[model samples]
Target: MTCKFILVTGFLGSGKTSLVKHMLSDWGESARVAVIQNEFAASGVDGKELKLANDQFELIEINNGSVFCVCLLGHFIHTLERLLDEYQPDYIVLEASGLADPINIVELLQADELSERLVLDQIITLVDAANIERSLAMLARTRHQIMIADVVLLNKQDCYPGDLTELSRLLRSMNPHAAIYPTEHGRICLSQLTESSHLAAGQYYGRQSADRPEQLSACVVRVHQRFTQENLNALLAELQHDCIRIKGFVQTPEDVTLSFHSVFENCQVAAVSSYSGAAELIAFSETLTSKQVRQIVRRYAS
Candidate 1:
């Protein structure tokens, strides 16, 4: 049977992980579901979170860059091929890196190797209700994400302080064909997202150009020393400026490993297993220089 493929795309911290976890909890037991999580950071913090939520589905982590990029496309293709031959899952969820362009991903799905075996099921884009305007104005990729979506989820509605009428209007302007659903904390009716029939290759709007635009760069900092909760907080405070997103695993001074995720000013630290190797913190910032990021890491290292 052909694997049903769903591509989930959104801007950084738009709650893609939470939505994926919820979907897994709802549909995992009934269907053989597998997820391919892509991150710009080498460390797989999102993968760790998904495993903590549930270990039933096959989890594949592709990090260090967007899976659709030329640098990582080969690995992404190989992994998809392997999953088809070995896992034979009924459904496959590709949780794209927040910075990914869904247009390129759609193009990849139509590639000869995957076209026959995998079906382009749906493209679900999550919009952070509070930050949609800012993201749309600042990020070119954000527009592309909305344009290609089969379903546009206006997530984080509870915390959205602005007027929904305007946001909804903006979303409609971007994709008149997409079904827009308002959601809180990424919660949505599973049927609305997953029950759609397989979409033909041409159904998705927008095609990426042969030459892809440059993506936001990332800096990975590997820390060997344990950090106190206070110390971690201090580091996060410093990261809020110039950094679009932060994620990785860190060992606390208490000897417990904690998964770290930060987007804009919001931060979350969840307890995880004891990660033995050097704890890493991956930060994505458009304005911060690599040298500057390394300097920040060194400050915390001391």
Candidate 2:
């Protein structure tokens, strides 16, 4: 029988490791499971965190880029084949890098030989409430990781004010169809993450060139003057670029500052509250980095 696989993703310090540890204990002897952890930076960091207590489940580590990219594609399939041949566990769980995106990871289970042995079970993307603003401003990769999630686990809710109204609006814009669950310290019920029986979309994905005129530029600037319907569409068209994400607040001339975020090619702008602040924006792309981001944000300072 083909094994079921779940891809868990989030930014660093999002409590993914803590969630996995609890899951292992919850399964107990009922379900035989295996773990595959892909670490972008340190190989052993996430693997060591999920220390297995017995032979009920086995854990494998894949350290490098990610399981979805071409460079590590061969390694990813090879490791799965080995796991199927050796353990043949009933289920598999993938702990993707904090910087990893789930769009490609889900595509893997839908394409090629690996699909034969492993079937996609669910995609759980953890969101860190405390560091989300900084992550959004600093890393485009982390934002994309959240865009393709099937079940978004909003971890670290205790750290911040439970501002679900704002979070819901942001998440809806990223995917519009994912189930969002807010949790404290990664304390989600095991059934919530593991019991979802939805299969992943088997479509393939690759980094493609941005199709807009501004996409061709090294740095495409997008300004959200307000949440006006016409202006929002114009802003999206102007900020086209390869691998870009947007976040921050927008201020209208009417003195309203709205929280805004964009994941992948999708952008969401809405009025949150009225403040004297001006509409602000921070963007990420191959050509945009931390230094450039600050400069860009300052340029649109309210």
Best by TM-score: 1
Model 2 CA deviation exceeding 4 Å by range? 52-55, 194-302
Best by lDDT: 1
lDDT of 2 by residue, 1-302 (tens): 88988778887557777788777778888888898887653223345435523335798988646666666778888888888899888888888766565566655665677767787777788887766766777656666666667778877677676586687678667766577888886777776765553433332255421112121112223444345445544554455453345544555566555555555544556665323333444443555554565444444433
Q: Give, for candidate 1, the lowest lDDT window spanning 10 residues.
A: 196-205
TM per candidate comes to 0.90, 0.64
Q: Supply the global lDDT for candidate 2.
A: 0.63
- What does candidate 1's lDDT look like per residue over 3-105, in tens digits? 9898898998999999999999999589999999998766667787788778899999898778878888888999999999999999999998887876766
Q: lDDT of each model, Cα atoms only?
A: 0.81, 0.63
Q: Give the TM-score of candidate 1.
A: 0.90
**Residue 128's C-alpha lDDT in candidate 1?**
88
